[model samples]
Target: MGNALRFLYGQCCSEPPTTTTTYGGAGDQQLGHHGVSSTSVGVSALAQHLYHFEITSQVPEGLSKHVSSSKKAQSNWYKKLSKAWRESKPPPKTPEEASRLVIRTLQRHQRPDIEVDARAVADGDTVTVYVSTSDAPESSRVPQEVHMAAVERNEARAHKNYTKADALQKQIKDAGYGVLHINNEEILARKYRIRLRGIDAPESAMPYGKEAKDELVKIIDGKCLKILIFDEDQYGRFVGDIYCNGIFVQELMLKKGLAWHYTAYDKRPELEKWEKSARAKRIGLWASSNPEMPWEWRKNRREHR
Candidate 1:
């Protein structure tokens, strides 16, 4: 009886035996025996937990979809920023300049369909433009006094002192520089005198001169312009093509008979065509049988002077 009791005690303390079993296919999972034993159940659960961990390890469980989206957005922004940096002439000089450039580029990207603005119209064939400080070339040199005035004006404005800011701004403007508020941002700009290319208008005292100037003003006043600079004239004016609201300025002047094609300087056939059209229609200066050429009038005036 004592020997039988010892054998029963040994059986109760011993672990249950496990049997290996092959699944349907050779590549399929091989598991332990499907017996009603604690060891087999624990072995199956462990395999399941490990399989789940392998899948989840590739991408952690706690991360959200927002993180992936943010990374994609950052990559897109980096691509655009790189392109803008390459195209930027005289690249950024400081952290502030870089920030401003990024902001301006993004704004332009957002409103690519809109037109840009010009400063003012000087005459029938001349325009005044303001180049923003951010767009200024590296070699551009601003007068020390003008730069100082600009700095002080910015500070004054920041402190809510409009009177002082206005005075400082006036001084800056007197020095041939100006601060323009574009898109609700303050931009310091340099002045440029631009002469319209491919056409010549009458002098202020000549026939239809006032009419030509008035017509140009009527078409471009308070409107933005796109200028393509060619060369600088002897009068320190930039000779360039001017487009206002998508209309070629020289073409308008020629079509209206307010200007001569100035074939000696510009040989574009389009200018000649427009002038001939206006002449045939007897528009503006064309109403006179023989209007004096502006160059001849200027030469005579110079000789008299």
Candidate 2:
């Protein structure tokens, strides 16, 4: 049971969602009028690793094939759920449908050799699961191979052996999973912070910075978020695509000119369309005569310090 959980913690957090929607009514509401910046000042107060992925490897050849097959089935279920969310839209009905979809996924996952125990955690909405071998009465609750793999993986991470960590990360990803946390470090579901991929907004102190965050808060504060991490930035933040209730938040940010397309890192050439539109419309940050990019601004701040 423990081994399977460790593996899951490493491989499952979220996936990129499809389509997009906007919470347009937000502008009328006076949320955080004092407009204190949260992304850097108050936010940087809490320390975080720039990047991390969690998962265990080392399943044997025969069993690994089975596991991979199971993962494909799981992925299909998740994709369908995402599609439904986008098609049906968010709200009173969406939540019920989403929950039922999850149950359906679990039911579909039933297998004779595995007993899947899943329950809601006290911390928040995330549901954790335990997978035990039920092939034989004498079998260990946590498969022996998975347990040993986790042990080795943890030892490598403890020694700062990132080479092993990277290899293990690749193994986990290839096997169709994403690690949400490592070693039980984050005790709360809210600690699962995801950064917007393909773009970076100005710091809180910078021009329009507060506006960007305010827009984000309006859009995602209560919406279900899906993140697909492609890589991690130097700051240790997971660099990934963010979907808020099936809407592509990054694209919206660009549409509003609330963020700069982080070309050096993500290189989303298509984002130029939204950026051009925002510039023509003189929206948000583009309202400034000559606004500084967040990357250059951060560099200047560091050099001055």
Candidate 3:
């Protein structure tokens, strides 16, 4: 069951992901070739079979026929398909619904689809979840197994159970998300997707990347950040402008030379000035005699692979 869930949540994404998004601004800057496509995995057929999605939509009768497989036609078809999917059904609105959608991602060519019965139990290293093609009436409540875990965590806190709280926190993190403590008042857990805006941090495997991430962690590891979401990216991450204790996150990263100014998407002159100062001062990655940009690195990596 654990393996099943893992596959559903992760394994089906085998394709080289790409997303071409043009940033609309004064110059109509094309995005850096670094964007990722949607995170939802699996083929359209498999996904539809598992999620009850339909591919056919009223894309004008002869709209596709006249195009003859041209690039422009492909783009139009993609937009039409995306629009159809959006208009067909609303996105998952609750945690349980979202989880169900994720679990259905497990259906692929190599694996059989499982039924969702809203029953899952976890004992030691063993986890058992009932699967059926026919879903039971959608339950507003979290699955019993997950709910029990949440209850245990709450009970631990009530008794000042540091050991239990710490353990449960690890468990939650292992399951793909983190726990948030609210003003020392309540335990909060929810799915979230926040991408720091106006700058791109180096991947952890790159030079000074760990330092950049570590600095971010230092700034807000145990605190809530003020986030203003501007939009959602194709990958479903929130394109958010974040602040730490009133300090703009992008500005600070620029000052430290920990991130790129993300000129492809943002064109603020102040940000460019900060990047210039960091470069002149030879701080962080700028200290390197020659540092490779993350976008270029990713591009090269993909090409070589």
Best by TM-score: 1
User: What is the TM-score of each predicted model, taking all chains together?
Assistant: 0.57, 0.41, 0.43
Q: What lDDT tens digits, residue by residue, belong to model 3 across residues 26-129?
A: 56644322221123323322233222212443233222222112223233333433343344345443334434554543222111112111121111111122
The weakest ten consecutive residues by lDDT in model 2 span 45-54
> How should the candidates be ordered by lDDT, best one leading?
1, 3, 2
Worst 10 residues of 3 by lDDT: 116-125
Model 2 score (lDDT): 0.45
Which ranges in model 1 have alpha carbons more than 4 Å from their true place? 1-119, 136-148, 157-167, 181-185
**Candidate 1 residues 57-157, lDDT tens each?**
32212211112112222233334544665566654433344456555654553311112233365556876777654332511466667756766676576
Q: Mind giving the per-residue lDDT tens digits that candidate 2 earns over 236-300?
A: 55567766568887888889888888787766677877888999999998998899988898898
Residue 98, model 2: lDDT of 33
RMSD of each: 23.5, 23.6, 23.8
> Which residue ranges in model 3 land beyond 4 Å of their true spot?
1-186
| Alpha-carbon local distance difference test for all models | 0.61, 0.45, 0.49
Cα displacement (angstroms), candidate 3, residue 108, comes to 51
